[model samples]
Target: MATHAKLSPSSAVRWLSCPAAPLMERGKPNTANSYAAEGTAAHHLADQCLSFGYSPSDKVSKVLAVSSKGIGFFKHDQPNKKDIAFEYEVDQDMADYVQEYIDLIDNIMAAAKAEGFFEQALPLESITGEKGATGTADAVLITDKEIIVIDLKYGQGNQVDAERNPQLMMYGLAALNEFDVLAEIESVRLIISQPRRQHVSEWTISADELKAWGETVSNTAKLIDSLDETSDLTDLFAPSEDACRYCKASAECKAYAEHVHRTVCADFEDLDAPLTVDDAKYDGDTLAKMFERIGLIKEWIKAVEQATVDKLYAGESVGDFKLVQSRGGRRKWLDEEQAEATLKAMRLKVDDMYNKKLISPTDAEKLKKAGTLGDIQWNKLQDLIVKPAGNPTIAPGSDKREAIITNPVEMFDDLTEA
Candidate 1:
């Protein structure tokens, strides 16, 4: 059996849950993702500002300015400052979104202030578990009510939910032992703020519950260490096609290799065609035409598959069609001059009086309360318009899961060992 150091709680869960992911991680060695780098830089700056106490330094100001410009500021502290970078860029028209993020933090801070729970943010600590395993948390907010642990994620994906996150629970356990205020700790709140989507998710778990979860993490670490180095990856998780998309080891994994080979063979068969002696006479133009036809066929097949899936899931028809209710000819009403002349005789202008704000708010309210206006017409009068196109329905017969290969040993070995 190969004895390897127990992986971090986060990495262990990822490796076990998605076996192929580690292989994928190993394959991309030199890809310098700038967005990731920026995120890391921003997070580090935020951690320092919150932990060491905010200073008016250029670096701190720069980060705060950038964060203020985006949707929201995410808070978390992790080491390997060089490993992960926080790099989520907001769309150009994201002023409102960025303000919302600031508002969320402001609200939390306000609550903390009102409760007298304010303290230095993200106080650092080296937590030592059994067998000298150690890890650090990003930020720790102390309050009169409870301790708040905030984690900032710059990624766009929704992988972490506060309720199910083991890392947050682990941090709570570590804090309990380190601070010796486990009894004073009324509750541990886990906050995950995603700035890209302007989303915030929080989970509050009791200290007792977190302690139990910590024990589970420790036991799982021990079990993982007991596994032999040569143990088949499939023993951990069943191999499947969905694994291939994000698998680092897909290039070398035997299962993935076989699948790719089969796919290639099938494609080759599709390109094969019967040829006659005279077929060679006009080869160039014919070959070009064949390629064009193949491209169109591929597009059609994809569209059909998508439509089928949409129909199955959403129970809606799919295809191009013009609305039958659309008119073909122009229908004219009274001319502006004629209408105005007639209205003038009655001492009323033919202008839109409703748009002119001629009616008082009291009158509008009275009219609305009287129920004389039909629901649809009333809503329209109030400038409430229903969307012409409803929400899109997923096509029926669409494959929900893409093909995946579970075993990543081949790919991992190739990338790492090589």
Candidate 2:
């Protein structure tokens, strides 16, 4: 078996939605991006802080490197495949965000300990009987009646909710399986601490509910394994925005392409027909439907464009399209100090070469928290802070913010003023 499972918990949402995704994504190259690398680095920092009971700020200025063998706080000289490695510097921003996650864990631990004897579990490994249904949890705290499994999401993209989340459910199942022997666990609390988004989401479910979900997971795994090389997968794949967002085969998947086509070119008679603007007057209902599916459509378009570019780069022809140089070269000083010195030697004015701007209100609040600004000064400055009314934009009805209402009297007053 491979070290990483085919039905990994991280990809649980995708695979569970599109049952054939694991098989279809075979041999697809999994490339790394800077965002993923940074997230991994943040996870490593959090792990270190939790393990050693040190502040994330303590690791500031330290380099976290990843080689082919695996990630670690190692030197750059470590040999690896293709001499390839990624390094991330521990910065103040990352430290602050990770400290929030650590603080959340500490708070949970304090409360759990107050209740009774609580045992903390690190690196909760999967012990499931189902093949390829393994995962390792970030942290797990087990008490007499409850188990808390916390997952730290460093990505600042879309906010991740914890309710009925497959990844967290898998982690909850693993934690229960690993530590239920020690404690009589009744309920599992899954927490997703996304410090980067400044959002923490949690959900609690009974232990029996988690085990029942586990059985469904096992059945899904069995369904996935039953597929042979010659089996038809037409009905096996179900594509949706969340499921197809990170699927490796999304670029070339026929079902996904068809889904996007239908989503964008709705009201058309033929699903495979070419799209044209002729007689295309979309109704309000049609427009709303398209808007809802716009994210998936945009993702599919981006994936197709990237795939074309990759093929072109690999000496393959993508119709009449070929790679061209883009207007992306923006020059910068190679050495800031040397450039400044040369500029000064040329009699350049200091004010002409430098920019001075006021710190933002947010940063000022940070200074106040850090004790750099006195309470009186901060209070005085608070009077100068002005927040403009946000512009109205489209949002779903489920949004927590109340709808902005334009009062008829205020509208008449504005018109009179005008």
Candidate 3:
């Protein structure tokens, strides 16, 4: 935001949607979480793997680079996969995921070898996405005919698609600009490896198309620079679900407030009082509008609450609505160890108090704070993930999620059997 490309390629979806976000979020403190820290450690391990061409051994330190030897030993164990991971004690699923990355690179290289390009092709390199961007690409494979820019997403929070990915395109353009033989690289392939989701998506475009996209990135950078130096940003900002969801300026932005105001004010231009859904008379069109705007309205409300909390923490108050604790709520064990000890002393059946039943890998993944569910447990759960047919529901055709597939014959068989 300080005259830099704060609209980085990784955050292009956000800044592009809300042009003035870079300056609006200036001077905000970043709140780092354990997930981000774990991601960083994973990225460090991946970068080291790329650099050294080896995987860490089981003896690699476990304390997440808090120790000197942790980093040193991680670097030392290069190129093979006995115990290669971000954390020292990785889950089996995590091991498989890391191995997937390694296997993917190998597959690409092996394919290149089969096609006879491995000899002259430049080896894959971990690269900064672009000259002006503050992001790095996990790997880039360069050849005379094609350039493949790859990103590895370690977190399972959400699956990322490679199709028309601005992040990967920026990486491709950056890699293109870095290499001298740009003309030889005819096409670019963008790949996103989300091993946890088992979703590896790829998108491809001509080198000319990728170069044209670079113009967009350059323009975005310029726009950010202009916004950063602007006096008043009232007109420059625009708010939408994509832009406002992660913007640090949610609490202070006037544009978003105006958006909320317009949405509600227009909805109730004729109403004398707050109209409940039961009392409201709306057509299909109005109902659809409400449906679309409801999500955004909820988001705004949540952000407003957080902003209020932030101000309250600093000793500010909103009239008489000061923060307070309810007299009664759900209770918990004051001492978890003592509670467990008591349960053991009583000889209570563990299954009565604890869930001994199997849970889905997705559910089991919630227990993984820094690593996988540990050892072969997750791998065993992998076979148990029976993705049943999803219930059919109506949605707009424009929705990006894949439509559910069903077998007519199977349905007919069920009816006949019944």
Models, CA RMSD each: 20.2, 3.7, 8.6
TM-score of each: 0.44, 0.87, 0.66
**lDDT, candidate 3, 1-418, per-residue tens:** 1122445667676776677887888889865445665666665555655566656333234434323223323444454434433334444455556667767877986675412111112211222222333445677776667887778888896567887876677767766666626447778888888887777888888888888876766676566666545367666687876678768888678888878767775653342345455655588877777676765677788788988877887898777778776698789999989999989899998777676666556557645523656647767767767778767865666546788878999999999999
Q: Evaluate residue 335 in candidate 3 and report its C-alpha lDDT on the 0 to 100 scale.
A: 98
Off by over 4 Å in 2: 74-84, 114-133, 268-285, 362-393, 406-413
Q: Local distance difference test, per candidate?
A: 0.49, 0.80, 0.65
Instruction: Give a tens-digit lDDT track for model 2, residues 1-418.
Output: 4245667788989988889898889888887888888988998898888887788888888888866666677565755636446888898789889999888888998988723122233222243344444466777877888988888899998778899999889878877887789889999999999998789998999999899888788788778878877879999989988898899998999999988877666554444566767856688765676678778888898889888988999999888998989987889999999999999999988899899999999789767867899999999997799999878977777655799877999899999999
Quality of model 1 by C-alpha lDDT: 0.49
List, residue by residue over 297-365, the lDDT tens digit for candidate 1: 343344345445545556565465322354657765459778666667778644742246566544554
Relative to the true structure, candidate 2 reaches a TM of 0.87
What is the C-alpha local distance difference test score of candidate 3? 0.65
- Model 1: weakest 10-residue lDDT segment is 116-125
Between the candidate structures 2 and 3, which one is better when assessed by lDDT?
A: 2
On lDDT, the candidate that comes out on top is: 2
Candidate whose TM-score is highest: 2
**Worst 10 contiguous positions by lDDT, candidate 2:** 116-125
